[model samples]
Target: MSDKKALNFTNWDTTFDNGTSEDGSRNCVYMSESLDYKWVATSCVEKINFL
Candidate 1:
């Protein structure tokens, strides 16, 4: 058996609020454990630390 989690349902929307088009350009979702697990939309090219 593995220790990794199965899934987490934050029910966050995958919309870019930076006035950017959601045409697979800025299509990335991330959650910050430091910020009380808040969701943030970012670029797919960005380097982030995953939990």
Candidate 2:
């Protein structure tokens, strides 16, 4: 009989420039599936900071 294995998963968060005249923020999330990977990008203008 052949052996089977479960898929491995990972999560990541990062910030990037939005490349616009107005100040923009970008939030990204990534997931890996075997040799392939997928990502989601969100763009916003509002800023939130906590101190």
Best by TM-score: 1
Model 1: per-residue lDDT, tens digit, 1-51? 287877666755444364454455667768866556678777787789886
Clashing pairs in 1: none
Ten residues in sequence with the least summed lDDT for candidate 2: 12-21
lDDT of each: 0.65, 0.40
* TM-score of structure candidate 2: 0.19
* Count of steric clashes across candidates, in order: 0, 0
Clashes of 2: 0
- The count of residue-pair clashes in candidate 1 stands at 0
* Whole-model alpha-carbon lDDT for candidate 1: 0.65
Residue 6, candidate 1: C-alpha displacement in angstroms: 19
